[model samples]
Target: MGKDNVTVLCNCATDEMVKDEALMDIVTTRKVIEFMEELCEREGYPKEVLTDNGAQFKSKEMEKYLSERSIDHKRVLKGKWEEEAWKERKGKCDDEAWKERKGKCEEEAWKERKGNCEEEAWKKRKGKCEEEAWKKRKGKCEEEAWKERKGKCDDEAWKERKGKCEEEAWKERKGNCEEEAWKKRKGKCEEEAWKERKGKCDDEAWKERKGKCDDEALKERKGNCEEEAWKERKGKCDDEAWKERKGKCDEEAWKERKGKCDEEAWKERKGKCK
Candidate 1:
């Protein structure tokens, strides 16, 4: 019997007696195979095996094992056990025998009833059985209803959460993309501005250098022109002074020669008169 009060009965068909039994929290195909193997080893392999159409019994592994052992496998139809049992009982007993047994049971029941105590007991048992059956049916119905309602709630919650998550993800992605694009644009603009400024600075520096060079060249040319003019003026002054000195020396020599010629002429005249 399972925790849910579901019972599984495993037995052989020959004597309808349980040879071996196992209580498991969860029964699986592997466990079933092992159980059957142990049973076979103890009782020897049977010629045939009969079972219901359970997943563990009808599985490929079970079928293969049975086939390898040359065991004929049979499956009884589900929900027909009661009918089969009735048929078997009918085959074993005739109608006259059933009527005889029924009459004997009635007579015994009437004799056993002393002071309505057995009837009261029977009524109590019947009431208890009906109550248990009703409770079982109610529990099954409530469980199924709860499962259906829970399934719908879970689905709705999942869909709502999924939609919210997707929306958030899309927003985040969009924001990141926009931020990246803006950064790229700003970076390119700044880079272009920097390049333009650098080029302008280079041009300004070159112009300043050229202006200084031109000023130095002009100063050098002015210095050379002044030195050449000073040299020409000194040469002309020296030539004028040399010409004045030569003219004065020539005048003095001419005067001395004339005085000597006059003296010699006077001495010759005086000696002739004496």
Candidate 2:
């Protein structure tokens, strides 16, 4: 069983198994390769592996996999190991073979492990030395190369910089324009407000003048009415006086006629009075 609690497959030759660590995650060919790589690094490569003709072990992928690592693959016949004794016999054969090769296998495993370690260390040192050399060369060459590159790209750089400057200048001009436009609009608004205030003042003055004119017209009309009433009363008084004078004259004429021949004097007085 694998750590994931699934059925695991193993090589009976070396008792090496591929395990799955994740739940419901089956072992795949790629995983098998990765497992084998780690196993070979630790235990060295196996000479051969034997398996039944299961799908995992019988595909072209498996063939290519074993071929790449130079591992021999042997497939057992189908239904050959149905008997329990044959299974036991196969296990015994594998154990005996392992015992026979155990000493030689240990020696080869040690040599291979030591050789791989030395090779890895040598490669690491070589890579470090090469990296240092490349860095030195890059530092030395970069100064002159960069200068050349900048020389070649100067026109383009200048154009790019000039474009940026122009854009900034245009933005500044546009900002100034917007600011000036805002100030103008504010000034216009203030002027309109002043005009509105002036209009209100004018309206108030007109109303005041209209009020004064109305007061004057009312006073003049009242004065004209009073004067016309006084004149009418005075004319009535004069008419009454004239009627009284005429009555008196008629009485005097009757007296003169009774007194005999004062008509001429009365006429002369009337003429002089009229």
Candidate 3:
């Protein structure tokens, strides 16, 4: 690399940028640096870097980045292509033939840049003139508007009219919306209340029906239990009477075994008791 050629600082930079609303957008600065590093790895290092006087060029991050990569750069200046190119291209040099071609290229680029600068200046002046004319026309228009507005309404009257108009518009809109919403709500509430009343009546009627059925069932169960208990008691009474009859029969058998038959049998027989 010779110092004759210029390296676009965009080469040394990756595609990162500083995009701010109050300033210009330079969103690809970091990306440009990374691209530069890749160039150093793939191709050779460039001579030097030429950049604009943007804050990003002088930023600490950019400085550190360049310093770490050992890249040199300078701010672009006017009417100093040779010096700028020497500074921009640190040590990048091709063959002598290429150098000659680069000189021709540099000459053409300088002329073109000068032409562009002139054109840009002319355009800026024209734009400024148009802006001034527009500002003057706008000022006149604003003054006329103020005059017309003043003729139409004074401050106090304008305020009162505007407030009343706004109030009436707001009230009309609000009342319409509120009435619609209230009507919907009232209809829904009436429907819900009717449904609730019907549900309550149905629930009460069902409860009464269930209660009557349960009471009848309970009464039947109770009567069955009482009947069963009475049958058990009658069975026990019959068993007691059978027991008494058996005991009396056993006593008569015992008297016969003792040779003391009944009075009728004793009078009719002598040893029939045997």
Question: What's the TM-score of each model vs. the native?
Answer: 0.33, 0.25, 0.22
**Which prediction has the highest lDDT against the true structure?**
2
- Whole-structure CA lDDT of model 2: 0.73
lDDT of 1 at 118: 69
In model 1, how large is the Cα lDDT of residue 8? Answer: 27
Clashing pairs in model 2, backbone N/Cα/C closer than 3 A = none
Q: After superposition, how far is residue 149 of candidate 1 from its true place, in Å?
A: 1.3
Off by over 4 Å in 1: 1-119, 201-274
Candidate 2 ranges with C-alpha deviation above 4 Å: 1-24, 81-274
lDDT of each: 0.70, 0.73, 0.71
lDDT of 2 at 136: 89
Per model, how many backbone clashes are there?
0, 0, 31
lDDT tens per residue, model 1, 1-274: 1222211224333223233333554556787778777666766777776566678887899889889988787766897655554554475466658778888888777777643776788889899999999999899899889999988899898899988999999899899898888899988998999889978988897898788788877777777777777767766776776666666666666666666666666667666768
User: RMSD in Å for candidate 2, one decimal?
Assistant: 26.8
